[model samples]
Target: MDKKKRVIFLVDMESFYASVEIASNPELVGKPVVVCGDPEKRHGITLAANPLAKKAGVKTAMPLWEVKSVCPQAQFVRPHMGKYIEASLQITEILYEFTDQVEPFSIDEQFMDVTASQSLFGSPQHMAKMIQKRIWDEVGVRARVGIGENKIQAKMACDRFAKKNLEGIFELNSTNYMKKTASLAVDELFGVGSRMKRNLYKIGIYTIGDLAKRPLEEMKKRWGVNGHILWLSAHGIDYSPVKNDSTELQKGVGNSITLPRDYIYKEDIQVVLLELADEVCRRVRALHKRGRTISLSFRGADFNHPTGFHRQTTIPFATSDTIEVYQASLQLLEHFWDRQPVRSIGLSLDQLEDDREIQLDLFSHPIKKLQLGKTMDEIRERYGKTAIFRASSLLSSGLLFDRATKIGGHEA
Candidate 1:
């Protein structure tokens, strides 16, 4: 309608990890490639690779042994977070030349809303081509661009075209979405992935057309929160505001650490748990909020088993005092920990709101006074984070102490 007023664009880098690897060594361009963790690591898996490796049936998240079998000639590269961050920042700067409404969805993908600036740059097709060229020239990376009326449509169109190896740009609306996407697997939808498609298949909706034609009420009956999202996406409706602001402000606060090694010692776990509780409270207070619930998560070295334990005891009073909060979390851990050797540990305090409520107490602990908290916070802020760490957190100087942490990853 009237030249598609809500013009949204999705730019996705192809084979991100592999592309960065080859960018450094052009000699590796045409080789089957895999970026994986240490092959000998107990559960390490491939993270990403080039089209050549994908064609040979090598895939990300596959065990290293399986990946090697798939593409024996494949070259493996370790992850370089520093390089990826620099490239992502550079690509974002290039996109800002066209509009400030750019949102980085991940390290390799972004959403841009140019609805207001289309006339300034010409039609959507011309805008996409110019943006793609700018990215290639400035970031030394190739990207596929998709134009639609909103974020969901643009992202799905990008995935659709990228899989077909077509030109870098794809434009779609309600009319062409189904026909253009008919041959593509529902699992290939930008947000569907494989697990989501499996769940949706149980409801007899196997394609974009199937989802688009289904009634909203029927969709909600089974999928709950996710159902509404899929239905709205089928109709190409995404009203989320593009993010253009800083991501520095803390919303929910938490802290965690890995043990030097697997530990079944009750005293050792209790020490790390107390230290993590203190760290979590510090972060929560720094944000000027009181928390009502504590979430505890931990893992063992054999990570096929991960345990998440959450405790929602109403804070006797909403307070950021570490001792009080840590006591509550200790009770939760005792209830959940089965005495297994744990490799990782974490604690979270949420259900946060403004810390406006004041607790009335005739005899409060003197150390829990407001002055002491403020004094400690200032000293840490000014001197350094390490200026004051709990004795329990004292471990090896190097990051080797956190080796057990990768077991749980960020599910903590």
Candidate 2:
């Protein structure tokens, strides 16, 4: 007996942030709506735009000024990341009603393996419609679904066809995916970006059909493992399973912030670094992990000709202490930074291990610091993150207070 084909669905929310705003506020339903970051904070890119806004030439990641120039009548809404996250959780619950094999691809997209669910829900097309209707009726957001024999086909089907289909459903299987997409530009493939497209063109492969016909060994020879992966993708092949591990271990904890303005002074930069270290260490401690390596990265204010440096240092002992991480990051900045005006800064704690054991240090009092961090975490968890904060957070150059009110660098 031949094995049954896999039935995968890639469900993507349409104009997620903008749709959430329109759903929450009925008055904005018919308007061309665009959701964007706060312009005052220098994060004024369009996060999402409704279909009407798209018709008016608004696109995601476009500068707010350009959006205004194209569509002056567009209604702009600031992002509410917290609400979007809540809605995402609600949608996940809805997906669980059909199958447990749901893997979130992003804030607005998910992959669901429903091969075993056909007996309960009906055919793949029927199941897709059911999922779309349930999400719309329950969460007040429209969803498009792409059906396929695997995750890659489903994703490509949704991005390339379903989103544009009137019914908002498309199926691209192993039988017809090539027939449908082979003649398209190589850049139209799932993972081919501009650079990859250029490289493929250098090899006389301009279309997906050209790539599919190329020998797999030739691809591997040119791009190594990534080349092999690209060759497989060109043939509509992917072996990755849909995973839904809620307790997945994080390899690192890091935070980066785009400063509202360029900071040329070392004192101001140090202040920002201290806050970043504190934030990252807090997250690391929350995960019950300690890290031995600290990485520091910064970008110069010049946008046309970007200049920056990223450096890492491994300490003798793993630690989740904010001061220790800050000190290490400070050393990197002082040693590597060319004293240029910096527009963004980031820090990360890597080479992580479970924080079940502590290495005693006579001079550092590691145990006391851990205890203090735990106490602070407890206080913040109970009252609020702002309930307990360092004195440096109140400094003129500090952004902890502003950042505390936000999630993912946008308003919460």
1-412 per-residue lDDT for model 2 (tens digits): 1257888899999989999999999999899999998888877889899999999999888989999999999998998999999999999999999999988888899899998998899999999999999999989999999998888899989999999989999999999999988998999999899999999999899999999999999999999999999899899999877778532436788888889998998888889998888888888898888999999999988867889999999999999999999999989997999988998898999988888888878999988998899899899879887898878778888998888888767789
Residue range with the least summed lDDT across 10 consecutive positions in model 2: 242-251
Q: Candidate 1: misplaced stretches above 4 Å? A: 1-4, 38-43, 182-199, 221-225, 246-332, 337-388, 395-412
Off by over 4 Å in 2: 1-4, 246-254, 284-299, 302-336, 347-375
Query: What is the alpha-carbon lDDT for the whole of candidate 1?
Result: 0.72
Highest-lDDT candidate: 2
**Candidate 1 residue lDDT tens string, 1-412:** 4764588888899888788778888888779888876544333577788889999998777877788788889888876656777788888898898898888887898888898887699888998889878877766678898888878778877877743666778888766777777555567666686888988788787887777788999878877878888778776778876676523223456765555567777777777766666666766677767777777877775657765444455565666777777788788777887877777677888777656565676577523554466667788778755676666656432222343233222111
| TM per candidate | 0.73, 0.86
Q: Least lDDT summed over 10 consecutive residues: which range in candidate 1?
A: 403-412
